[model samples]
Target chain A: MIGDAFTLVLLDPMINFLVILNNIFFGSFGLALIAFTVIIRLITFPLTRRQLHQSRAMQTVQPRMAEINKKYSDPKRRQEEMMKLYREAGVNPLGCLGPMLLQFPILIALFYAIRQTLPESPEALEALSAHLYQWTYIQHAVPINEFFLGIDLKLAPNEASSYLSPAWLFVVLVGATTWLQTKTTVTTVTDERARAQQQMMAYMMPIMFAFFALSFPTGVSLYWTINSLIQIGFNIVTYGLPALKIEPLLKSPAPAMAPALAARSAQPQSVAQPAPEPRTPNGPGRSKRQNRRRRPE
Target chain B: MNNPRFFAVGLLLALFVVTSAACGKIRQPEGWASPAVSDSTAYFFADKDRFVAVDLDSAKAVADPKSTTGATLQPLLWQFPSNDQKDQDAYSFKAVYTQPVRDGDTFFMASYDGGLYRINAPDGRGERIATQADIKGKIVAGPAVAGEYLVFGTTEGHLYVVNKNNGQLPVGWGKTGKDLGKGIWAPPLVRNDTIIVATMAGEVRAFGLDGAEQWQKRFTASGAVADLALLGGDSIFVPTLDRKVYILDAATGAQKGKEFVAEDWVWSTPAFAGGVAYFGDFSGKVYALDITTMETKWKPYDAGHRVKATPVLIDGVLVLADRGPVVHFIDAANGTGLNAVPVVNAGTVRAGLTAAGGKAYIATTKGRLFVADPVKRSVVEVGVGGGK
Candidate 1:
């Protein structure tokens, strides 16, 4: 039942649309995929923009959040302050995740769609037929040309006939653009522990996609590569060059400390001494001690 | 607890794992076994495990469970042994390609597992008389039997001539044996005293009764050749992966007339009736060519899917099925669709259309059999499990 619904909702439409786009693109499967990716990116542009805006909002409020952590010793009080700060900034902590979550379904659907578009076997051909809608244009577009730029769109990128094949070019694009997109979009975390995790992901996500592109069809990798390039473009437009730039100074603990110190020094000298407690690894205060203890690990 | 980025990282890992594992193969749609309709019964390989026999008159399983007096009800006339492990890789390209060839009282079948079985026609009980496991090559095509000799080809690039009487391979076949150079992927066409064999190496050779090559001709690029059709016992109509059908003189293997160029590869064996040859290309275009003039008699009909199934001529109508569900009936003379909507909303048919006893039987990959009476303009879908 779930399979039928999934085909009906995503696979069927994607397969049909891909076939239609293949016709429009004059039977080039690769061009159709590139066009399809562009169209999908445009359709989800609003959500992506909102997600980027939410990430920027999160970054802008990070210093204030750290200050709240310094001010409140109680865990509940710290959470309340963080929630209040988020509300005042009109930022939902999970807002950036919504679009990413939505894009997952589309990505999965596209993967299957690419596989279905140029079916190698008769069984797959039958599936392609079933997924295709009854539009006259789409019906006539059966057996779309799978060859584009010397790559058999059905075979994996890494499964290229030789090292000199164009499939290797797709692999490079998938890897490079994925890395660029992740580098531009990943938030610069303030907390040491979270920053480490974020940095790991920034490296890992692209490498994972690149590794997957090796085995996935060149057409799908083409989609991912183009999608990544589009995302990099969106990122640069949204946040400027600074989004892509990873400064050594920004990597230091100095920027995080500066904001907390600046906020603390505004208070009286006696309260300022308490600010140092927030930095202590084994600080006696509950939230400060918990956070500091968690950071070193 | 407060690390959204860390949470996202974990989720990405999980997604990678899930998608990678799930990405291996989409659910194999279903098996496609074309119906072999005899006078009273339709024998079909429903799947790897089941070879079902259905009563044509009642359009149901021959074995009626409700009416049987025995304690245990045998559902059909017979089913092949249901061994999943033995037939694990049966759905691949090497799976059964030959339609059940009935010779005398026995039916010869070549399965995907590379087993050639001789089933008793009366009961369907079978034995694997030959196997690829023993031959060291999968039998991708054939069991086209004649008289006492059964001729077939294997993916191992050799043709085997097996004795139908005792199921023993003749000495002069295969690599450790004769070695036909490349694989024979299509069933050879046997005529008179000679058998015409098309090989994966793109060479068509006619072999004499004594297993000696009579005449050989290379027509296309080295790969598998589609089954060839004989035109008036003088010309050989062979489709090739080269996207053109070549008409070769049967006597000398010389080119005859112009090459029929198609938009895509011509894989279906051309069917000839009344001087016009009908066939479909991989691009879903069906053409009716006048062999004498080497020109298309009418505009090609687009069936809107890959037409792998050979077009059959029934009662002056050219019947063909595509990879899609719909079967099209084209007017033999004009190439126009016969029905109002051209038989809309039927089972997805990949198997060839079998016209027998004034009706056409279409077996889909999903195992739905559509019995269409073109005279009546009506179609009845037979159920997968039991016949309808």
Candidate 2:
């Protein structure tokens, strides 16, 4: 029953929309997939933006979280303090998961939609007719041209007969863009152990998705590559290009570190000391240090 | 894994695995090869990879083990590409779609993987005659045997004419095969010296056995033609995906009359007997049209589900199976339900129904076979190798 409802609610709509898009894109299923990715990304933009904002806020509170971890040895006390710190920073740890969760259904449905729209076999094509709406336009568009930019969209990279086939190019793009998307994402981990794990994930995720692209149809790989590219753009916009020393285009609404840094600086000290500034790894501060060293006396 | 970042990544990976599993095996072909019965043994695809020969007499005598009476089914007579041959790369057919075409003592079958084999009926011993390299694409259309030549079309739009004796291209035919430029999903109809080939692009062309074009102009339908039938000796019945069946001149690719519009897409080739053509549409409505006037013989019989299998006339009763997997028996003379309650199968029936010895044989997508007695209005699941 759940499967039927899923087909009726999500898969059917997605398949129909894809068929319509394929028609609009001049029967190029590849172009339709790219366009579908863009549209899905746009529809879920608000949730994605909120997730990015939460990630940014988490990054700003990392120092306080680290301090709390050090001061409170008891696990309970540390967890309590951590929750307090999160509340103060206006960060919801689970907020980052909202968009990810939303994407799962869409991804699954899109997989089925791609398979149905660009059927590889005659039986698959006949099976497709049952899902189609009675729309004459959609009906005529089918037995869809599976070729897109010289690649058979129904074929996976592993299914490619030769190493030189264009399908392998999608595999490469899926890996490269996934790595870039992960690398460009702002890190929120303060603990050394967690930070190491996060860093490892930044590498592992790309490899994992790249491996999956081998088994997935080239159309799906194309979607992943395009989605990852869009996400990289989103990451750049939200977290900025740290390597290029650019500030985030959209600043965090709360600026969670400012009050904490100011309060710490106001505390009286026996000896003169520099006020603690929130560490922005590979951010403007690192560029400032580099600029200072480059200056001539 | 203790870290929240790790947890998130782990969850994402878990979801990927679950979704992939839920989506089922990617590119797995579901074989719906119809049964080809010769004498007491029925030859059909038992699975995507297993082609078995079942004894019809044993199948009828075997009681349903699932029933309270407790009688087990018998083992199959034989199966092609035996356990030993399955491991050999050359013997793999992958997925058989074409019904095994019997020519005397040997049966010919083609697979979706583009391999063709000639299997002897007695022992089920088979040898690959054509490989994927020779066909260049998947074979969905069944091969038609014409004297010494066996003709079949591929999904890549190439029509192959190989010698039936050996899998070699005939000497007079094109070296690489004639490129139709569109995928052929329907089996080519062989009539006299000409071969009628219908493509997925909805174009119907006639060609001679020597690979020469026999038609001055090709008849093009609005939708893809899935199956074709010979109305008489001179006319062809073309069932198309556009919900219209057109009668074309068999000698020349010309329309004989206006197309008969159906309630839905017509995929099944019309079963002809007497002066009427019997068929069904995707909408579950069985149709009977007079070949002479191209008019309806009676009100369309409602089968209550999608009908993909071509109906077979058994003892003057029209036996049809629907996507419902429900077998309906209709009176051939006038379109009326012959069976009060239809016998439902365990899976969807896509293969064309086969009639022999006054009974109808059905092979479902789930690999289950059924033998229906038209006279008794009863259907029995034919278990194979002690299993249903």
Candidate 3:
């Protein structure tokens, strides 16, 4: 049932739209895929923008987060302080996830849609008729030209007749653009372990997707290459290229921190004096500390 | 470890892995080559790449091996590109779409990889007569055999006429092939010296044995013609994706009558018997049209699923299978349901039904062969050895 709903809602519409785009783009499926990627990016712009803003806000509160970690030795106390800090800064730590998770369905749907639109087999082509709408223009537009700039869009890089085919070029573009998109997006984390994980991901994701492109059709690779290129553009506009010292083209609202967070981080710590505690009623008292000391012995 | 960035990236990578695992396999063509029966044997693709010759007599016996009438089980006759020859690249045809056309003991078949083969049906030993380099396009439509000349069209829109004996292009047919400029998905209809070829671009043209245009007036449909049927010697039934089937005069390629409209795209080539045309549309409704009046013989029977396979007339009953894979039996005269409960639980039938020995032979995409008995209202899988 879920599969039926998915086809009804996403796959069918995408397949039809692709055929229409193929007609409008002079029967080139490659151009249609590129246009499709651009349209999908535009449709999801609001989610992407929100994710960028959340990342920026997370970056702005990094210093206060570090301070909280150092002051609270207890794990629970540190988590509480972190949550409080997050609330004060108006940042949802999980906000960046929503947009990324939402895009998975669209990406998978696009994969199936691309495969259906540019069928390589007779059976696949006949199957295409079922997914298509009843429009006369769309019906005539089929058996669309699978060749784009001398590369068969229906074949994968591994399936290419020669190693030097244009399919390999698409694979390279998918990897390169993905790496650039990842590198350009600035991610901030208070923990060293998290930063290390983030750095590893920046390299891993590109290599992984590039490997995937070897197994995927050239049309899908074209979609990915164009999608990553658009993402790189979005990154440059939203987060800027820090390594190249380029400021974001668009204004970000998160750089202006909340007053409560600013005041807490601005305080001076005395190395010679004992730290003050008992800020909240649930906070550990001296009796709890005594119990900890007695239990260890 | 608790950072949202790490969690998000990890989740995204995991989703990619799941998505890739879900749909990783490259879509390979599942051939729908229907069984081409000649005498006691049925020839078809037992699998996508393996073409086999099954002894119909043995298959029927095996289907009911314990019959009180002394039926005994037996193995298949032979399979082409045998297991021993699989390592040889020359034997690989990738996928076969065109049904094999029989000429005596030999059969001619075309593959999606553009290789044309002539196999001796008695032993299944095949020779690749033409390679992909020779054809230059995938063959979707089956070759039409007319005497010593064998003609076939490619998805590249070029039609080739070759000598059945030598596999070489016949004299005056050009060095390569005659380009029709549109992909030919429907098999060309050959009647004596004239070959009628319909294209995916909706052009219907008739050419002679020497590749000369035979029709003076060109006929074009609003949509791609999926299949063509010959109604007697004077008219041709062109079933198109435009949801209308046009009856054209065979000699001049002119409209002979009003086009028969259907609820959806008409892909099945209408089966004709006694001046009545029987066919189904993609919308699952099967209609019987009386060519004398160009009107419905009866109300269209709903099979409740898409129908792509051409219906066959067997013993006064029109037998056709829907994409639902459910077989339906309609009365050839009145279009009433013949079988109270239509034959169910069959494989998806995309190949056109072949009638032989008073039974309909069906070959599915998964390479399973079935024989349906109209008398018994039963569909039985013919278990060829090592099938699917």
Q: What DockQ does each prediction reach against the true complex? A: 0.10, 0.21, 0.27
Cα lDDT, model 1, residue B379 = 62
TM-score to native of every candidate shown: 0.59, 0.84, 0.86
Candidate-wise lDDT, in order: 0.67, 0.79, 0.78
Name model 3 segments beyond 4 Å from true: A70-73, A187-195, A242-245, A255-259, A262-297, B1-27, B50-78, B81-94, B130-133, B171-176, B291-294, B340-346, B365-369, B373-388
lDDT of 3 by residue, B1-388 (tens): 1253554565565468457646654457776677888778788887889988777665344534545644344358888887777678777887766678888888888877777788887788887785222675778876889778788888888888888777777766875588888888888889878999999888899998877899897899888886887889888999887688888888899987788888888887877888888999988899998876788989999999889888789889888888888888788878888773334444577888999989998888778787888888777777665331
Summarize candidate 2's per-residue lDDT along B63-90 as a digit string, tens digits: 6667674644655888878877888987
lDDT of 2 by residue, A1-297 (tens): 988998899989999998889879887788899899999899999988888877777777776677665445446756877786776566887777776677677767777777787787767777787788877777666577788989999888888999999999988898899789878887766676677877777777777777777877788888888888898898888889979998888765754544754465356542222333344453322345554666798
- Per-residue CA lDDT of model 1 for A186-277, tens digit only, reads 45567676777767766776676677777777887888788888877777666666634633222212112244545654787577543333
lDDT of 3 by residue, A1-297 (tens): 987898899989999998899999998888998898888888888888888888888878777677665566567867887787788788888877765676677677777787787777776777787799988888778667788998888787998879989899988888898788778877666766567877777777778778888877788788878887887897889888888888999887884557865665566645411354554433443344544655755
Among all candidates shown, the one with the greatest TM-score: 3
> Cα deviation in Å at residue B77, candidate 1?
4.3
| Candidate 1 colliding pairs | B157-B182, B157-B183, B325-B348
Candidate order (TM-score): 3, 2, 1
Instruction: Flag the better candidate by TM-score, 2 or 3.
Output: 3
Measured with C-alpha atoms, the lDDT of residue A158 in candidate 1 is 60
